[model samples]
Target chain A: AQSVTQLDSQVPVFEEAPVELRCNYSSSVSVYLFWYVQYPNQGLQLLLKYLSGSTLVESINGFEAEFNKSQTSFHLRKPSVHISDTAEYFCAASSGGYNKLIFGAGTRLAVHP
Target chain B: EPEVTQTPSHQVTQMGQEVILRCVPISNHLYFYWYRQILGQKVEFLVSFYNNEISEKSEIFDDQFSVERPDGSNFTLKIRSTKLEDSAMYFCASSDGQGMSIQYFGAGTRLSVL
Candidate 1:
């Protein structure tokens, strides 16, 4: 079965500091990788996705992830993070077209002042 | 941006009682899905609906659970008999099912099975 792994359970960083949330996925078939963010008391929101073409994908909020097939990872990174970025980040992968997404346990990012 | 909508942000039910969680997916989306997340657990997919039928389902969606698109707008998940383990945050999501298949999720209905 396809699965996702988020190595870091929690990451704390000072505001405006660089941070990375590690995510890895395992799937026998080709997969579509995605990064979703969930704010407090809110639903999952799409941060970015890697379908094809570029090896790296960027979200509007300065977050980006690279698709590295050799490493089986799609790690989310931001050079500078804000306090608003504090939330639960989930890494997910879906195989083929329109399949169910396999999600990681999630990484909680805490941005401090 | 359009968003999926779910009714009754929270639901409380006793063990062995039946409950229905309702969702209104984005109007133009072709695929709808149900996912659940236990507190501090990974989000788990329960079922996916498309074209008035179930396209895919996970083992967690057993005989005790059923999904229905009773009307043009409402998609519902009915639990025949709720269990303590069934207490979780139920999320409804939908995607256009086009090229990328980016799904948009709604604020979930937190189901509390007492």
Candidate 2:
């Protein structure tokens, strides 16, 4: 079945350290992928997304994701994470447009000062 | 910028009781959606509303779950006779349905069915 998968459940990193949150999805047809972040008591916030055209997508908050069709992966990365980046990150996918988003199990990124 | 709004950030109810979650999507958004996340689980899609009616729904959205846009501004999800297993964080989201439409989400309402 079509689904989103976050390989890591939790990632602990020191402030100013590089981090990567691996995500993979399986879809028989074309798909749109996204990265969403959720802080404590907050809703899921769109961090970045890849619809087409570009193989790499970036967010305003210094996070980037590379979409690899061959690997069925869209892994998020940050060269240097801050303490404020501590939160649960979700990877999601949809058939396209406004279709329902299938979310991954989520990866909790804890950046320590 | 406009954002989606959901009321009653947290709700506590007893099993077998009915509960209604309210949402006000962005005024110009053409698509509305509902999703839920059980504790420590992924966010699961419940239903999607467009043109004042349900355009899509998941198996988790059974007969007991219904959605409505009673007025021009409010979209509501009603759960008839809630169950203990129904406790989850309900999220309301909306999108303009334009090119590569992006869904914006509200903070969500944490429903605890005791």
Give interface RMSD, every candidate, in order.
1.1, 0.8
Tens digit per residue, CA lDDT, model 1, A1-113: 89999999999999999999999999999899999999999989999999999999999899999999999999999999999999999999999566888899999999999
Rate residue B44 of model 2 by lDDT. Answer: 97
Rate residue A48 of model 2 by lDDT.
97
Note each model's CA RMSD in angstroms: 0.9, 0.9
lDDT over C-alpha atoms for residue B7 of model 2:
92
What's the TM-score of chain A alone for every prediction? 0.98, 0.98
State model 2's lDDT.
0.95
Q: Write the per-residue lDDT of candidate 2 for residues B1-114, one digit (tens) a residue.
A: 889999999999999999999999999998999999999999999999999889999999999999999999999999999999999999999999887899999999999999
Q: Which 10 consecutive residues of model 1 chain B have the lowest summed lDDT? A: B95-104
Question: Model 1: what TM-score?
Answer: 0.98
Model 2 chain B: ten consecutive residues of lowest lDDT: B94-103
Per-candidate DockQ values are: 0.78, 0.88
lDDT of each: 0.95, 0.95
TM-score of each: 0.98, 0.98
Instruction: Return the DockQ of model 1.
Output: 0.78
